[model samples]
Target: MATVEQNVSEFRGIIFLVRILFHADIYREALLSRLIILTLFSYFFQNDWSQAVTKFYRTPLLYERSYLNFLYLQNKFSSTKKYKKVTHCLFDLDGTILDSEIIYHKAIQKICERYGKTYTKKLQNQLYGVTDRQLSIGVVSALKLPISVDDFEKQMTELVQKNLTDSPFKEGAERLLWHLSTSKIPIALVTNSTDQAVQMHAKARPKLFSLFHHKVCITDPEVKRGKPEPDMYLLGAARFTPKANPTQCLVFEDSVVGVEAAVRAKMQVVMVPDYRIDKELTLKATIVLKSLLDLDPTLFGIPAFKDGVKRGS
Candidate 1:
């Protein structure tokens, strides 16, 4: 008896002769005939029937392994359109969650006034969502203030702390935070703000800020660079309990620099920018919303609200 293996191997050798049947119909019919013949052979083999069927199914169609790999590569190349799927969310603090841009501007302007200098809008926009060192150094250098970087940092911190302790939340900010929290989605605060700044800002709404799985402050010792550099966002994404990759995270921001950081980190970002921010800068984000209210969670593969953005307070 030519064993079942020998019989199947012989069939495969015979099929290989017509390997040039690249046309779909020809290949399908060829495979169909092989399967039908195998079915009939199974009746006689009995014990070896399972073995014969297994080998036949496993080897045909360019061989199973090659067939599966082809399908996978085809799906990926079938469409150039990008799709976003996120399990973790990273959010920028200041302007994204809290209406602290004006507070920052006021603080810097106060310092400028004391030094007989002006805090221009151009400089204010540049300094937004940047590290304390970057902000202090840039401001002191730009305004030609006599204060040292350390002195500027100290003054700016004090003013921000005093005014920002009661800083209000931006439109739809609390609602979105609460929604994501209740959905059991992991969220992190990724910001250029210092630890002290975060503490001061969280005073009024500690519980809301507490909802964050972790906070990534650029001032943290591990962070070598700030926003527009991707270090902080990458660090934030890595802090998840089951650490997440950049592609698995979606960032929310209100600053152009923040958007650039998320994009560089290989993550998708939603920009809820200040009206004063230039439109061109907002375009860099994956999507731009007039306010967080306009966000559609499903677009980013997040669960949609049960009651549609939740009403009240």
Candidate 2:
């Protein structure tokens, strides 16, 4: 019953409302806007449902939802880990493989105690993943110990010799190593520990140490810098027979320094941190596991262990 001019004026008004509804942030408003869009659509075609059906893709609500969904999918895909074809595994030796962190703590505590100071939890957290020189400096400065870095190193070496550095493997470490070795996947040991420290551990478990393709200690002639710097990790990957791209190596670490080193190398890291470490600190890793036993190699596209058992099997 409306005149042509009147219908055109109403159509323009509908278009203005369509703009507001499409940009609406509230879901309720967006839903209401959808209804309004449908009503206006009906009005525009003079209730020609057949034509609307033919052009549903041109309708704003369906198109808007599709756009929103596309944005959601894109963001979701980006947030997930992209390393599915990991070819080599690199491990941190101290806390990640050996139960040597406790031994290091004990030796440092002895040095601090000699100066009428106690090694605090705060300090231990800082030492995690640090090099021996950094450890000496931190302990000396934090405890206000009356000793030079060299002196501290002297006492630490003496103390470490008395207490065994070749401590037992951490939970599930040996099993995981065996599985990887059996699967014929290359493995490397990357550590910020001194050469003497690594030899002690390797001496204690010659057979176990043999599983590694090679070991990279910070004292290696080729190492330029220690962890929290990517130097050691980069060297470890390069030592592989065929060599590995940084993106193709998967690192397993238990300290903030190790994880950060791996991340700086642009490699994916799985963290198995001590309970004392801040959960927030471990968040930088690709994934955080309570222990090596909790990891599933297949998650990184590595071979499944025998019998198809997932954890501690």
Candidate 3:
């Protein structure tokens, strides 16, 4: 006869084998049942089986307790659609919705030459989306220019006017603006450009400017700070709601500082970055687009742009 240890070892091995066989049978039966159900459904419903099954199994009793999760989610999300929360569209000037980057590049180059300094793309990026005084001081510091800040500002202001124009619109930018205006979504223009430059650009591209319910520029005496400081973005929000909860608006920008400022203001931002703004910096933005033209009504949670549009005269 086998010893106690030997018998126990044999018994354990047999039990393990039996357990494995039982599991194998259960799995095989489950698979077979699933296949049979699928075959029957397919034979009757053809391509529509999935939809039919989904509709049929929508009841809680047909599924596990966890299946009710989506129902709760649906209810949770449905309430948001009931009330149309005022959505404001905040636009950045310069390289964003406008093709003002090239003009600014030339303007900065002229300022650098006047001050006996060289302007690099990196330096321009650092200064981009900043106000005239702020840009002058920042550029002078970054380039180690010998010129006084006052002189630098004067030269840049002159050069910017000479070089800048509203010639070509960013792809879909005009269309998106039109859609937003028609949808009755209040829009506001926010930029670090001086009041003069902002006005000129707006005059040239009235389609975009006209869409905005309010326009906030760095030139405004009340606006003491610029991008990366959150002042301009906050000012833009005030245009729509004085107590503008940044959470209610969507900001569109093309620079790192712009996105940072929008984030600081607690607003949703979409970045359409240029060569100067890095992808990493734009990560703070809610959405990053190749261009403003890429925006659609669905982005604002609307079913369609045409559906919501209230034509403006």
Candidate 4:
């Protein structure tokens, strides 16, 4: 009969062999390791050590599989931690929340046609994130149109107001806004658009627009500068009832200039740029999502969607 010490030594040997098998990076890396495992298995079975033999057969395989699964879960968790929670939400209007960029594009194209200048996609992209004044200045300068900036802006404004009657919400925009409102998240609209223009655009969905706790427009006296400058976002946050720390606020933008403005305001920004925009321009944002559809609110510590609440619906 084996002494108690001998039995303990045998159990320790089995544990050591199991550890090696479980941790092996490559099972074929060494012939000796494989030979040792096989030898131990044979010895345990020959001794009729039922428990030891069963453990030797199952423990290493189970442990190795579980360890690999653990590594996968660890990687997944680390990826999701990239986004942080925010208390207040600010949104850019034209290309971000409302599909009103097309209205702007058509209006600009009409003006370009009058000047015998083509409104190229390049020009459209370059002027995408600027305020009405900036866009007017850019258009006049780029095309050398024989018109005053104020006059050009007036023409574009008229065209936009006429065409803005039924502008649809951008994909995932309505759902996200609804979710935020339902959850009682403080939200605001910070846009380069004029207050009048914003109202015109909202005509189709006044209830949704009404959900915003505040609307800070470029035309507001408090916003001295438009995007690519932080005035608009800073004012938006300040207007919140209790006010929000810039660092605790989150901004969603669809243009490079808007992202820069949010960053300058010292807020985290999620950029959902037009597909045609250059990817390099979006790199400065805290996160770049294809659309709000890709946003996992839970990543920002907000409640995630429940079952049956489809995104972009």
**Worst 10-residue stretch by lDDT in candidate 4?**
67-76
lDDT over C-alpha atoms for residue 102 of model 1: 82
Ranking by lDDT: 4, 2, 1, 3
- Model 4 TM-score, all chains together: 0.72
- The TM-score, computed over Cα atoms with residue i paired to residue i, of candidate 1 is 0.70
Residue 159 lDDT in model 1?
87
Tens-digit per-residue lDDT, 1-313, candidate 3:
5578755654553353333334333443343234335534553554443353445444445433212222222223333543223377788877777787777677888778876778886687676666678778998888888878898888877877875773467766777777777777778889887788877877776666877788888778878877888888888887675446677778888888888998899887777776334323554666565656444446456446553433310
Q: Report lDDT (Cα) of residue 112, candidate 2.
A: 85
Residue-by-residue lDDT tens digits, candidate 1, 1-313? 7888767855654353233233224443455445536644663566454465555555545344333332223222323536588899999988888888788788888999998999997787776667778889999998889989999989988888777876788888888899899988899999888887887766677799899999989779999988889899999988999899899898999888899999999998888766555443565677666678767788778888776553210
Give all candidate RMSDs, comma-separated: 20.8, 17.2, 18.7, 18.7
The TM-score that candidate 2 achieves is 0.72
Error of 1 at 184 (Å): 1.2
Deviation of model 1 at 222, angstroms:
1.4
After TM-score superposition, the amount by which residue 197's alpha carbon in candidate 2 deviates from its true location, in angstroms, is 1.3
The lDDT of model 3 is 0.65
Q: With candidate 3 superimposed using the best TM-score fit, by how many Å does residue 56's alpha carbon deviate from the native?
A: 53
lDDT (Cα atoms) of all candidates against the true structure = 0.75, 0.77, 0.65, 0.77
The list of candidate 1 runs beyond 4 A from truth reads 1-82, 309-313
